[model samples]
Target chain A: MISQFIFIIILGAAVYLFGKNVAKVRRNILLGKDTDRSDNPAERWKLMAKVALGQSKMVKRPTAAVLHLFVYVGFVIINLEVLEIMIDGIFGSHRVFAGPLGGLYGLLIGSFEVLAFLVLASCVIFLVRRNVVKLKRFTGTEMTAWPKSDANYILITEILLMAAFLTMNAADYKLQALHVGHYVTAGSFPVSALIAPLLPAGAGALEAIERGCWWFHIIGILAFLNYLPYSKHFHILLAFPNVYYSNLNAKGKFSNMASVTNEVKAMLDPSFVPETTEVSRFGVKDVTDLTWKNLMEAYTCTECGRCTSVCPANITGKLLSPRKIMMDTRDRLVELGNNIDKHGKDHTDDKSLLDNYITREELWACTTCNACVEACPVNINPLEIITEMRRYVVMEESQAPASLNNMFGNMENNGAPWKYSQADRFNWAEKG
Target chain B: MELNIPTMAQMVAEGKTPEILFWVGCAGSFDERAQKITRDICKILQHVGISYAVLGTEESCTGDPAKRAGNEFLFQMQAMANIELLNAYEVKKIVTGCPHCFNTIANEYPGLGGTYEVIHHTQLIQGLINDGKLKAEGGESFKGRRITFHDPCYLGRGNGVYEAPRAALEVLDTELVEMKRCKTNGLCCGAGGAQMFKEPEKGNKDINDERMVDVIEAKADVIASGCPFCMTMLSDGVKHLNKEQDIKVLDIAEITVRANGL
Candidate 1:
């Protein structure tokens, strides 16, 4: 009965995870219609190699970088233990590996235990750095929407993960005391020895307790896995690709003006251009207009606020905050996603998501200086989105700063931005 | 007939295989003091055995100001016409006295299929000095004169030609004091990007005014620059700040011409 329950639970969890992940991938593909320069396969691969495997972005801050590296590696390697836990739950044996393999498994578990302890220690330091140390650096100065819930979630998740680890050790001790079937518990023997003395003196009750603890450990891991897609921890999956595919050039150099022109023309006249109108306008006005990569960026934002700390515009008291823009776009996107899921695409009467969210003043205040992009640890190019929106406002709606409009008109008439006669163009020269 | 003010075609028809094309930009051709310096550069080049062709009244604005103003179409048309005119003369290279025109032709013209080797007159003068083609008399060294170089936005940040202008100043052996923000991180002269053509938005301090104080702080005898736009703005800033008598604005070309005793 226990084996059947474990098997059904594992199967259900796997299916749910796979289905949700697929839906996420599909939604992203559908949303990321505005990403420029997807033609170069070699460039994409090179970026992936450097960003994903190398952990390049995290290294911007040394202390945080070191802490993240261990957590990242620990999170990845410990999946094997998760798998082992699920298998043991079905098989009625605490140890899955036998003989030489069993010895290796014990070693791996010991190593994982040490890494877990390190990750916990680093996470504590990170918390202190963010909270007690009161370092302005850790504050997400850019994103005002960074919920207080995020810190709580991180703290609780760490504690829960540690709980899972301890419970597994307790189960291991009970199994050893019961004289379980032979499986080399080599490296784990020390853990079992320490745990054995702590187990209840009544052997009969210990077996039942061991089974219950095993179930708790498995459920704890599964619950954490399911919670990942909904939390800021979603960055663990998204940041890898986000960093890899990030623009390799300087901030302002990411997209050319010529490319933007081509896109605008294509949107206006599809028959002449033959390129399908994937999304209207240049900038991301709503969540659906954002490219999947941008949506991924929204999900991946750890709310670390590193981008805001270095923004020249923010420091100078400009209304633009790169982090806030990203979070606002993301919040609207999530709301839009929920609406779409609930009501389908036919629900067009719903109010425009962008109007209620980002203000016109916030849009105009940005100087397109790539400082925010440069400071971002996760490779979110907020300036690109900001500029694209500006382009749309200027070209499509013909709405821009009144002074800029007059300057553009003057440029059209006199070939100079000043409304002087063409004859007087060289007046400055004659005076010299 | 369309008024042909000694176009490159006419110059070529006269059997002139000019050693250089002196691109007197729109500002230099019209502004009085700027025109004098342009004429000075022409006379200097002529004396140095370098025959140069002038575009005269045929020259027009480089359309940089238009492009920066967001009139992309007008800028494109201007670029296309300039390219055709330059290519008509089989112009292999150009030397401009204007930094804006120099930068536009050197950096932006290639995008419009007009690729020619372009150099600022200051850079050419520096090269000439280096090659022993131009010699300067070291009579009384201007060493004690604290001179600061104001980096033009177009020539410095837009094109990364900071060192060449500084190099020209270094050859003169003056006490070159630098502002806190110089070279790539240099602040603008409140000109360039067509900002000169428009009234500046109300702000606590003018960018150029803020820049002039750096020169004042250095107690510099001169505020030198390679770009004519910077020269004009910095000169105006010095005067506006009532330091015109104490601090003078001189183009690197003007300074170079003086150093050569021309």
Candidate 2:
């Protein structure tokens, strides 16, 4: 009765904290401007299935894909055992499914043990890949202390959770073998059986170790659930919705702002009266100017750096790194969200996502080749943000680079991007 | 090599409607390097007995560069002017040798109320080849020559047209070599998104030089492309590598004209 009371209190606290943080994040994302992407539910569902569920794009890099698949699949499948553990914790029961599930429970436990081992191995490899091998993409300028440490912490946490799971099962198996206390003997422990012998024999020692491991595992999972909202691991939840609401238009087609289009149309008309001569900002100057989809994209970044790895500008040693763009947007959103929390809803900041985080050199270096957009496994479009910011720099500030200014002038005057006039458009035909 | 290409106004005056409007893009109209491609396309149209008319002085830029460079106001002004001319002329079907123009007219223009059946010149040539209107047997046949295609980003990935240019080239008796990165995975030749209008930022290397390494690694005798901007960039790359004498870069229209002996 005491153990069950302690379990209920801990579980309640964990659920409350996790729910509060998740709700906070949802509210933060809603701070962005509205963009209605409700069209075409069929295509959105298909994209979610292919990208999130099938993991089709992840397989582009086969080695990382397979390793990640082990952890991902292990995390998913082992969580079933977590569900059982939670129930057992609440009721102060050991192997509650053992009698009812019988052979199926044994099969499930055996598979969980194998998967736990695989998850441990994959986590170790992932750690080595990030720290020891120091892959160029992982160690680039963007992988600063927080992101690097965050990755290491997640891996270490996963390793510990899997280790605690196996240790708990090993002690439980030994206790069942000795027919000690209230421990039952029904489920199998294939991998942990190897561990069972290493543990000291006796009922009291086994029960204490088993309960300690059990508490550690459950507490670790709850802590991980809460940590996700604040870490890049947030992608584990956001990737599904991100891919589902991905931009389905052809990659070449950029979305036009309807307001700007209407303004341009008014200018083009022969007889048009301006209703409001009041100035309208041409493009995004702040987070509120960006669409909700853009903000959601900011939150969904995995920081895998596949985008920066394949970025032509980054590879060619330019200032542009698509991964950095997403990271900056996320950081700015966090800053704004925190500001709102501290100073109430009407809070405003002098620092915007533009000059405070991303710079002109970075934005200008992008060729808009869509390489980064294509390379992103989760459909995070840094290009969209880049283009929007570029529009702000150009239209709002009128601060394009000198060469681009020349091109813009040519287009304005000659109706082309070159110095030549429209009257000369057919000059080559005369030569023919 | 003189080709008599009629203007749309001339055709209209004669009370005749050409099957298609030949949208000679700015590069094809003004750039010396792209002029040869323009003539080749005109020669092919004549060879196949397809009546085509140019807008002549009435033609203007499609504002692709302006839109890309974040000058939407200027782009719209240019686009609206051209749309007015196109709508007045009643140009139903249009074909252009430039991918920038093709992409803008086919995709972007529809949003601004300027919609037409915009097709790339390679697609038009492939259709003519399929219709058996143009013969591939004659002068300067590419028989057994190693030819690799450099996909223009706007044409290939931008518009999802990886096959039409290749299909047009398949008629030649040459070995069609492919770069390591082709089709959807093809790299940019350093000249998209208004980069053509300005100098490249300080970098370890130019994007064209990097793409040139792939082209040279393929070891093809000739490099074929469909977009004029790509032609300019790839030609500059070939010159930079000093392979100008060893390798040749020709537009696909030029290839068709040479193969059909037009």
* Strongest candidate by DockQ: 2
Can you write out model 1's per-residue Cα lDDT over B40-143, one digit (the tens) per residue? 67656765767667675456667765554444444556666677788877787899987778877876677657899898887887787778787656333566
Candidate 2, chain B, TM-score (2 decimals) = 0.98
Cα lDDT of model 1 by residue, A1-432, tens digit: 668575667868766995796486457446655555465668767766666666675676788889988877877887777777766667665566534475676678777777776677787887777668867755544423345457656766775675557555665556665666442343464444555677775655666665666666667666666766666777777776777666654332323245444443454457646344343454445666656666777777777776666543444354556777777766776666666678896454454434576665556555443446656767787766565555555655676667777766765566545455666654432332
Best by TM-score: 2
- TM-scores of chain B, in order: 0.92, 0.98
Write model 2 residue lDDT over A1-432, tens digit each, in one string.
Answer: 998999999999989999998888888788877778889999999999999877888887899999999998999899999999999999988888888897899999999999999999999999999999999989777789999999999999999999999999999999999998788887799999999999999889999999999999999999999899999999989999999989887777777666666677777774765555433566667776777888898889989998898777788888889999899988888888899889999989799888888888888888777878878888889988887888888887899889999988877777667899888888887674
In candidate 1, which residue ranges exceed 4 Å CA deviation?
Answer: A1-4, A7-11, A34-36, A89-107, A137-146, A166-184, A188-218, A248-284, A287-293, A349-354, A419-432, B1-262
Error of 2 at A107 (Å): 2.0
lDDT per residue for candidate 2 within B2-104, as digits (tens), equals 6989999999999999999999888898899898899899999888889999988778888887777777776777887888899888889999989989999
In candidate 1 the C-alpha lDDT for residue B110 amounts to: 78
**Candidate lDDT (C-alpha), each:** 0.65, 0.87
Q: Residue B123 of candidate 2: its Cα lDDT? A: 96
**Which residue ranges in model 2 land beyond 4 Å of their true spot?**
A273-280
- For candidate 1, state the interface root-mean-square deviation in angstroms to 1 decimal: 4.9
